[model samples]
Target: MSQPPLVEMIGIEKHFGGVRAVDHVSLDLFPGEVVGVLGHNGAGKSCLMRILAGAMIPNAGEIRVNGSPVSFADPNDAREAGIETIYQTLALADHLDAPSNLFLGRELKTRLGNLDDARMLAESRKVLARLNPNFKNLQDPVSSLSGGQRQVIAIARAIYFDTRVLIMDEPTAALGPSETAMVANLIRQLQSEGIGILLVSHDMHDVFDLCDRVVVMNKGRLVGAHRIDEVTKDDVLSLIVKGELPADWTARNLEAAQ
Candidate 1:
């Protein structure tokens, strides 16, 4: 805990016309930790993350990475800062193979400036192996892969570029139990590698199981933040629904339940 946070969003605010999408929100993500951003559909969690990802510019407030202030004009800026976002869409070209997708825009080239298929394949294999050893369909189109495999491809692409802060939105959405488990294991591995993760999820189980801490947002404002062991699922649910912590909420309440 002595180490400084890897990413900090202080007094972040975003407005859509007269509507406030994010209101004076502040968040911190430490190295090797997973912080869940929980909220209903319109609670501004996604907007806040998008700003950090450089997908959207915040109307006000400042973002700090490794204690230095930064401004992102676009997603590429964020990528250069070692921040990557994996949305639910996965964003893969259906016809492209794993290696092609891994280096879609930033393809490696030979000295003569020709596409380097062999080198790209080798690099893809290395990163994918670190994520999923069982994966062997390197030549297969990503559309043919399972949901979990596709998720791996998306995640692999992010980390292959030396991502330091990862924002995953509904990472395990629509996956079966085994696939979800695979993603969970991947998350733990990334954490072990000292990557800071900001997880946005609607599934209580996924948040509780994977996150070290949880922060809730409601009506464009922060409602509550708690450690995983200090709050129950119902406590988070109350914050999401009522826009505030429960009246009698306390860390001891969770200990008593156990």
Candidate 2:
């Protein structure tokens, strides 16, 4: 039998005063798989992601990790459950170096009751090497690093804590070709280790290239879910613009319903 998904958000709902930002939506992320979430701005993608990241609570829904029901009070609660989110901003302190930023809030302390710089540096190197072998300058502040390097730092911090589910928002946004390739390699590496990833991105190329499955949303509701190989860009675009599934998709549903 197949194992349960690493994470499942079922029938999620969210509202802002009189506005319904997210309707009843369900999504799942499986181990060693990448699921891409696509939608235009104000399409409720961010709101849904925030709920999954524990930055916002759903007005109604259920969240499960490893088949067990969970309720996240905050981002820390999500982190404790092995869920990590790397927002678009990267969320790294510019003045801090890789080791410092990696262990910013969750610092390692020595027996003498002081910060363990040595241990932190060693741990930082190990994680960075796993993601970016060319990564050096562990002591240099993040402000001095390039965009890709800074992204590496953010991703490293997320996975350093035994992360099982990673939510990345616009991970390769504004990155150059080479930098984008580097991040892509790191994503593949993570998948090989059985870590499930939920990627929310506007870039269609990235979605087609990296994701195993694509889930499209429109007007706060899920339009459809499609396997990467089974659907075309036009099919996804039709869903985004018209909120209608492709003819083939509709036929498949009809066959399944009979």
Candidate 3:
């Protein structure tokens, strides 16, 4: 028998006053899967991810986590459901150090409710060392770190927290090639630990290289979903532009898109 999906979004719909921002789109994300959602600026891909992250409420449709229905009132609701998002801006406080940023708004505390300084620093150090070996001194101000270093801190914060489902929005946008590559490596590490990932990116290479599956959106509707092993980069691009599968989708993908 097939495994139950970690997340299932059925007939998800959202509107902005008179405009429909997300149409009847549905998606199933498997455990330990890296699923990419891609499309043009107005395709509603971000809207969908925002909804999945519980940043917005869909006008219609059902969202399921481990097959149980969910109503996400906000991002915190999604986080409680094991979903965490790293926005394009990353939302890190540049003035804070790595450990401070990691524990922002959710600090570790002792039984007496005193801030657990020793435990938080030691634990953050451990997780950071594993992912970015060069990282040291979690107390240094983030302004002193490189772009990739800051991104690493953001990703590490999500992973350190028990985030089972990670949502990354345009993670490498406007970064240098080296910075982007660093983010890619971080993603691979997250997947190795069986975290389900939803990656929203503008780079095709990032999508093709990092994701197990691709879900395309266009003009507020789902165009197609392509398994990375069964489709080409060009075919995924076609779906992004044309709002449908390319003529050459594998038989299985064609059936799935239909």
Candidate 4:
């Protein structure tokens, strides 16, 4: 906890027309830590993360990577700063093979200026193996893969580029229990590799299970943040629905009241 945060968004603000999508929200992410961002459908969580991901420019605020202030004009700039986002859509090219999808834009080229299919396949194999050892259908198009496999491909694309801070939006949204477990294991592996992750999910189980700390947002404002061990699920739910933590929620306060 003494180490400086890997990424910091300070006094972030965004507005669309007359509505404020985000209002002076600040958040920090440290290395090898998973921080969950929870909010309702229109609570501005996605908008906040989009600003971090460089998909949307904030009307006001500053972003710092590794304590250095940086500006992202687009997603490429964020990627260059070691930031990557995997949205709920996954964004894989359905017709492309796993290797192709992995190296979709930033393809590895041979010395002769040809597409490096061999190397791409090998690299894909390595990264995919690290994420999912059971995965084997590299030649098949991503559209043919299972939900979990597709999720793996999306994640593989993100981490393959030495991603330092990952923004995952609804990572386990539509997966079966087994597939959800697979993604959870992958998240743990990423954490072990010292990646800072911002997990935006509505699933309480995913938040509690995968996050080291959880922050709640409501009506375009931050409600509060707490260590996962310091609060119960109902406590977080209260924050989500009520836009604030319950009075006497903390252990110390509860003991005092008792």
Candidate 5:
């Protein structure tokens, strides 16, 4: 039999008082695959990803990693389970350089109780080489780096820690076209490395280009999931806006399958 997906969020629900921020949403991410979560501003995409990342507890649901049931007490628990999240902010200290940001809270220490700068720098370079070969600003503060360069540092941090599942929230947001392309390339590289990625984005182009499958959410519910090749941008737009499959989309899919 084939191996189970890298991670599964089953029947997830979250509520804030009377508001149902997420309602019975389910998502699965497989190894080496990128799944795009597309939705509007209040479509509950962020809430679902937050639950999976252990940033918030769900009102009702279960999370399975590699076919084993797991409950995360907090984000730290998620990290311990090989789950890493890179938000829009990139979560890097602006004053720090690439190596410093890469090893931020989890810095390496020498036997004499000192920072192992040489080892950290070498390891950072090794990982960055795989993600962004042109990245060579080792001592420049992250604030000095361009948008794409900063993204590289964030991704390098996640990958260097042996992340198995990565959740990227609007990674290309606020980036120029070229910078967006750079980040896209890094995401593709991560997918090739066999890491499962849950990409939450408002950009339809990024969704269709980078994701193997597109999952749509609307009004706190899962609208539908379509393979990248199975649906058009307009079809996805209809789902996002209407909270239902586009007219004739089901017919088209059935016809194609037959």
Candidate 6:
């Protein structure tokens, strides 16, 4: 049998007024795995992810981190537990440089409580160098950086802080192919270092190329999850829209068996 997941959710439910944003969703994420959460508009993907990141509290559920049950009171509470989310908007300060953005709220301080500029810069460079050696000039304003570079800085910040589980919502939604490829490579690097990633994406290509497993959510409910090797994009999309498995998936399975 496979090892237990690094993160597990049991009976997760979240409500906004009378509408159930997330309905009895259960998920497991293993270390060094990328699990894609794919759904169309209004499919509750963000709601479920926010709950996992503790930006939004669940009305009912049990969360397990490293096999120990836990509850989070706030986003900071989740951060303390190594859950980091990079939202679509990126949540980065445009006026700040890469190092500044990396250490924005969690700035390093000297023993006397002054900013430790050297330490933060060194850490930022080290993280970037590990992910992208071509990255240069951490002092440039993020607004002046290319879209892909900005994404790199945001992701570098998350990974550098030792966040075990990174939730990236539509990380490549607004980028060109080359930029997307860069972000995709960075993702692989992070996963190779044993990070668990929950990726929410509308792009089938991104999901297919980067995810080890695909989870489909439709109408606030999980339709199915299949290992990438077990199914095709068409099969997962059918489940996303119709809440039904592709008619040929069983036939495909049978052919593979023979």
Q: Who wins the TM-score comparison?
A: 4
lDDT agreement with native, every candidate: 0.92, 0.89, 0.86, 0.92, 0.88, 0.87
Every model's TM-score: 0.91, 0.90, 0.88, 0.92, 0.90, 0.91
Please write out the lDDT profile of model 2 over residues 1-258, one tens digit for every residue.
299999999999999998889999999999999999998888899899889889999999999999999999898889988899888898899999999999887899999989999999999999999878999899999999998889888888888998899998998896888878877887888999999998989889889899999999999999988888767788888888888876666433345568
State residue 227's C-alpha deviation in candidate 4, in Å.
1.6
> What is candidate 3's local distance difference test score?
0.86
**How does candidate 6 score on lDDT?**
0.87
Q: Which is superior by TM-score, 3 or 5? A: 5
What are the per-residue Cα lDDT tens digits for candidate 3 across 44-67?
Answer: 988999899888999999999998
TM value for model 3:
0.88
- Give the Cα error of residue 188 in candidate 6, in Å: 2.4
TM-score, structure 4 vs. true: 0.92
Global local distance difference test of model 1? 0.92
| Pairwise TM-score winner, candidates 2 and 4 | 4
lDDT of 4: 0.92
Order candidates by TM-score, high to low. Answer: 4, 1, 6, 2, 5, 3
Report the poorest 10 consecutive residues by lDDT, candidate 3: 247-256
Off by over 4 Å in 2: 246-258
**Each candidate's root-mean-square deviation in Å?**
2.2, 3.0, 3.2, 2.1, 2.1, 2.0
Candidate 1, residues 173-258: lDDT per residue as tens digits? 86788878878998899999999999999999889889999999999999888888888898899999998778877795556887
Clashing pairs in 4: none
**Overall local distance difference test of candidate 2:** 0.89
Could you tell me the TM-score of candidate 6? 0.91
- Candidate 5, residues 1-258, lDDT tens digits: the string is 287999989999999999999999888989999999999998999888888888899999999999899998888888888999888788889998889899987899999989999999999999888767888888898899887788878877877887999999998786788878877887898899999999999998899889999999999999988888888888889999998876666545667789
